[model samples]
Target chain A: MLKIEGLTAEIDGKQILKGLDLEVPAGEVHAIMGPNGAGKSTLSYVLSGREGYEITGGSVTFHGKDLLAMEPEERAASGLFLAFQYPVELPGVGNATFLRTALNAIRRQRGEPELDAMQFLKLARSRMKELSMPEDMLKRGVNVGFSGGEKKRNEVLQMALLNPSLAILDETDSGLDIDALKIVSEGVNALRGPGFSALVITHYQRLLNYIVPDRVHVLVNGRIAKSGGKELALELEAHGYAEVAA
Target chain B: MNAMTSNAEAFLRRAEALATPAWVGALRRQGVEALARSGLPNRRVEAYRYTDLTPVARAEFGAAPKALARPELPAQRGRARMVFVDGVLRADLSTLPPRPLSDAAPLLGTVENSATAPVAALNAALAEDGMFLDIPAGENAGLIELVSIVTEGAGPIAFHPRHVVRLGEGASVTILETCEGPDGVGYLHNPVFEVVVAEGATCAHTRIQREGQGAYFLSSIHARIAAGGTYDNFTLNAGAKLARNEIHSALEGPKAACHMNGAQLVGQGQLADTTTFLHHAAPDCASRQTYKSVLTGNGRGVFQGKILVAQVAQRTDGYQMNQALLLSEDAEMDAKPQLEIYADDVKCSHGATIGALDENQLFYLRSRGIPEKAARAMLVQAFLTEAVDGVADETCRAALDEAVMGWWQGVAA
Candidate 1:
């Protein structure tokens, strides 16, 4: 579903993600495990078409379309979603409005009919019920004054609504407790299908246990150095990134 | 004579021709004299530095034509509705006719000091007709809709409508006031409001100014609150080529409170200014002010807010915040927040923020599949929602929200 070749990116004068290559075929969930400052977040940001990052060289393609050539919104409309590590707080924007706007925008881009307000609320409520989220969460401002876990759950809720083909989970489990971790993992696992794929980016192996990945890749010094099965996560957890990376 | 002198003379001539009671004539004389002294305020005046009224001084305006047809009015939701056209109360269109100014002569020109307020002085000099509502003690007067429309005219016309709202002790009322003018007409709509909130009473006033693109709107509101009284005011300034909304709220007795909030949406070639002054004169009084401005194209926005606490006003609490979002690089915003405290035991804080839309927030929205234009509009609406939410009345809030949405659609187009 996604492919990258010699992807090199930088912010300002400093370089990050130096000539990294990776790929996730259709229906496979992959995990990118690395230590601090290992270009995990940069890779996710570069893939999502965030500004301020200069693409020095290389290319990324999603579903046979050049991802780097698209704008952020176009990237999103093309079924690329990035769950931000630190979800932004929109002070006065209600969560329901944001969700519906996003869903309708993508649906319009895909040549589908848009849902009305009542239709949207009904769909959102059932999704929230499955995720064990409160109905009041829709009434509040988007991520404004939300708890750490609540923000992550809100991200998962958005993922469920948008139903993207590929989602980049960027350290979404950092601030979540154990119970939240399971719910978020279950949310991701529920979306596991032949048409869905994800790049679960994390620093630790804690999230890997809940949402088991088909492949585990160790990213070190801006490059993916090793690839293995699920046992690789256990190895890294037992030994640590330093030993496993070497 | 100079342009300013001619402008003042024209209004003075109109004021002198009105055959009213001796006290009313004296008040008109005071107003004309005040205008003659100050003329049109320039940058030299500290209070009027950001806004220049030279256009008003240079223009020659005629009286309103009596045959002009009234435009459509907003849906009224209140105990009664009053419609005014060209500063003349349209008794045929009004369901509740206010008492004549001669009846409220004692309270008409007593709330504000017209000598220092040029626009209020101008309004006073040429003022003819407006609303005068007097709620009796302990009476709960429901919402009242006051609509002012400046009909299409042959030439540029100027009108000054004077209003008075006096709530007796323990009385309460909510006012939804709107001012609109015909497009392509270069008229002037200068209105003055004097409000008195008696002891233990509450008064909520929401104003919406949607003047024509060629119109000039200059409004002044002076309010006084007695002990245990609360005065809440909210304004939405969305239209007019040049507009200035000035408000002065004074908490006179102990435990009095005042709240002022407003939003201004200024587009190309438009200039909107909101200046406010809050005076905490009694002990344990409180006041809050929040204003937001969104400027696009070559629009300009100015905000000047000041809070003053007197020495006798111990334990006074006051807060003021003014924020602006500039959509274009050519757009400009000038914010000046001042706090003067003479009391030792007072809490007064003020803050101002002026900048473009936050990039992080914009990207967050865009990354969620919202188009760039839609994302920017959503962010701007979010920025303005904070101030609009301050209105206590839901109907008034809905009106403001509709106006805001209409403005956003215009801007987006």
Candidate 2:
């Protein structure tokens, strides 16, 4: 469902993703583990089509379409989702309202009828209950004054509502408590089926124990140096990436 | 100085013909003389540095227009109605609430002292007709709407519609002052509103300015709140070639509170200014002020606010904030927030910020499948919602919200 070949990206004229290649077929989850400066976040940003990153030499294809040429919104419309590590606080834009706008924008692009306020409220309320999120959060500004764990859960909640074909989880487990991690993992696992794919990026092997990725790849200095199965995550966790990359 | 010679003389001559009370006439002469000496504030004056009055000063002044023949609008219902045309009151179109003068006398009792404000003096001197609303002691009126409609031809027209609202002890009311004009007309509207809230009284005064683009509007609302009284006001400016709104409030009694909030949306070379002065005179009074402006194209916005705490006003709490968003590089914003406190045990603070849209927020919205322009518009709207929500009246707040959105549409297009 997704493929990246020779992806060379730089930020502020400093190279980050140098000649990177990755592939994730449908109905599977691929885990990308790396050291602190492994360009894990950069890969997600590039794939999500964020600006200010110069893609000097690379090709990213999603579902047979050139993802590199599309705008961020176009990528989202084409079913690409990024769960940010730090969700931005948009004051005065209600949480529910923001979600509804995003949902409808994607729906409009897919030639689906937009949901009205009542219908959206119903759908959102039910989802909030399932995710164990408080209803009051929907009334407040988007991510404003939210706890770290709450922000992660809110991101997952959005992914569930958006139901994107391919999801990129960038440090979703970094600031989460054990309970929040479990809840987020459960949420992702529930959506695991045919036609669903995800690139789970993390700094540790903790999240992998819950989601249990089908493949593990270690990224160091902007390039994936090693690849293996689920046991590789545990191996790296026990021995560390310093020896593995060497 | 050259423009003031002939213009001042003509205005004085017109004022001499009015049959105003002797005291009021003298005040008018004083104002005209002061204006003559000042000669239409220029850029040399720090307060008017960013705003030039050359265009307004050069326009020839004319007599107030006759009252329009249309029925009163539904929005103008309730509250006393005062109409002005070309700097004069159209008494035929106004309705005064019945009252006992001896029992329900005005709080200030008609400007007995000489005035320092030239324009206010001029308004009071050549005054036409005004409304006096005296809320009986311990009474509450939901909302009072004051509609100031300007209808003039090519020449400049000025009107001073004086409003004296006195809230008796424990009385409450919300006053909405709206300034509007006929479409496609070029005119000037100068209005003054004075309010007094008595002990334990509460008053919320809101002003909406949506005049014709060719119109030059200047308005001043001077309010005085007594001990234990509360005053909340919000002003929205969206129309006019150049518009200025000045609000001055004095908390004279202990435990009094005042909240002054305003928002101005300018587009396509438009100019709008919101100036506010808050004074704490008694111990334990509190005051807060917030003003936000959104400018697009070559539009310009100005905000000047000051909070003053007197020596006896101990334990005073005052806060003021002003923020501006410039949608285009050509757009300009001038903000000045000042505080003057003579009391030792007072807490006072002020802050000002001016910038373009947030790029990070823009990217976040765009990445969610929202178009760039729509995302920018949403952010701008959110910036304005802060000040608009400060208005206490729901209907009036909604109306201002719609007006801001409409202005955004015109500017974005």
Candidate 3:
């Protein structure tokens, strides 16, 4: 469902991702484990089409369409979602309002009828319940004062609402506690069916245990150095990144 | 000697020929004299430094003629609406409870004589008709809508409306005031409003100015809060080629509280200014001022606010904040926040921030699939929600919030 070949990108003329290549076929979940400065976040940001990242050379295709050529919102309309590592706090912007705008924009692009206020609230409240999120979060500003777990849960709630085909989780479990990790993992696992895919980026092996991946890849210095099954994550954790990377 | 000055002077001459009581004539004469002395506010003047009225100095605008139709602007329901057209109260289109009023001639002279801004003095001298409301003790007047409309006219004209509101002890009232003008007419709307909040009274006022693109608006508001009284004022300036909204509040009695909040949105050659002064005369009074401005396409926004704590006003707490969001690189914002505390025991703080819409916030919204234009508009509205939320009246706040959306739809394009 997602393809990246020789992805070379830089930020402010400083090279971050150099010739990184990875892929996640349809209906599969893959986990990318890497230590700090391993370009895990860079790869996710590049896939999401965030500005300030200069693509030196690369090609990213989603469902056979060129993803890099699309604008950020266009990519989103094309069913590409990125759960940011650190969610932004939008003061005065209610969480439901933000979600509705996004949902309507995508729905309009897809030639679907727009959801009114009541329809949106009903859909959002159910999804929020599935994620074990409180209803009041919908009334507050977008992640303005949310706790770490709440923020991560909000990201998952958005992912569920957008119902994207490909979601790139960028270090989403770094700040979450154990209970939050299980709920977030369940949220992701629930989306693991036909026509759905994800690239779970994480620094530790703890997250992979909850959302067991179909494949495990270790990224080192902006490139995939090793690819294995779920056991690889345990090996890397027990042996440490220094030993496995060397 | 200039055309603008002469035009203002000619307006007084016209008002003089159509005179009435002696007190009104004398007040008009003093206003004309004061305006002739000062002319239009120049950049050299301390209070008018950032805003330059020189650009419109050549164009001439005379006193407006009789209005033909009433303007229909958005208003919240269940409020008493008082309509005024070209400074003349339209009783045919107004809804007000029966309340006796003092002689307008004397009130006009009093406010005109004590006015500080020369333009206000000009309004007093040439003032024609206005609004008067007196709420007795312990009564809730609910929300009163004072809507002023400048109907389509043949030529450039000016109008001044002197509005006076008095709330007796323990009285409570909420006012939703709006002013609008014709789209293509060049005119001047100089209005003066005064409110007296008696001891233990609560008076909340919301003023909105959406003048025509070819018009100029200059207004002044003076509010006095007595012992244990509370005064809240918010103004939204969204139109006019040039506009200035000046507000002054004096807390005369102990334990009084006052809130001065404003929001301005200017685009292209439009200019909007909000200046406020809060005076704490008695002990243990608190005042807060928050003003927000959004400027784009070479528009200019000016904010000048000052808080004074008198010597005897010990334990005074005053806070002021002014923030601006510039959408275009050429847009400019000038903020001057001052605090003059004569009392030894006081807590005062003021801050100003000038910046573009946060890029990260924009990206966050867009990444969620909101188009760039819609995302930017949402962010701008959120930025302004700070001051709009300051409106204590829920229905009035909802009305203003909808107004912001309506404005964003037009201006964001």
Report the number of the highest-lDDT candidate.
1
A-chain TM-score in candidate 3?
A: 0.98
Instruction: Highest DockQ: give the candidate number.
Output: 1
**How many clashes show up in model 2?**
6
**Arranged by DockQ, best first:** 1, 3, 2
**Alpha-carbon lDDT, every model:** 0.89, 0.80, 0.84
TM (B chain), model 2: 0.89
lDDT of 2 by residue, B1-413 (tens): 55444534555566678766543554556666765655555576666777766566666667654544443444454456655444444566656453332232233224322233544554554555565677888999877777776653525566655566788999998877777776555576766667788999999887788888888786667788899999898888888989877787889899999999988988876899887888899999989888899888899999989888999999999999999999899999998888888999999989999999988888888778887888898899889888888887886787778778777888788
> Residue A28 CA error for candidate 2 (Å)?
1.7
Instruction: Report candidate 2's interface RMSD in Å.
Output: 0.8
lDDT for A14 (candidate 2): 98
Tens digit of per-residue lDDT, candidate 3, span B156-209: 777777788888999999988888877777788888887788999999988878
TM-score of each: 0.96, 0.93, 0.94
Q: DockQ, in order, for the candidates?
A: 0.85, 0.76, 0.83
Clashing pairs for model 1 are none
User: Which of 1 and 3 is ahead in lDDT?
Assistant: 1
Which portions of model 1 show Cα errors greater than 4 Å?
A238-246, B1-7, B16-23
Reported per model, the fraction of native interface contacts reproduced equals 0.83, 0.65, 0.83
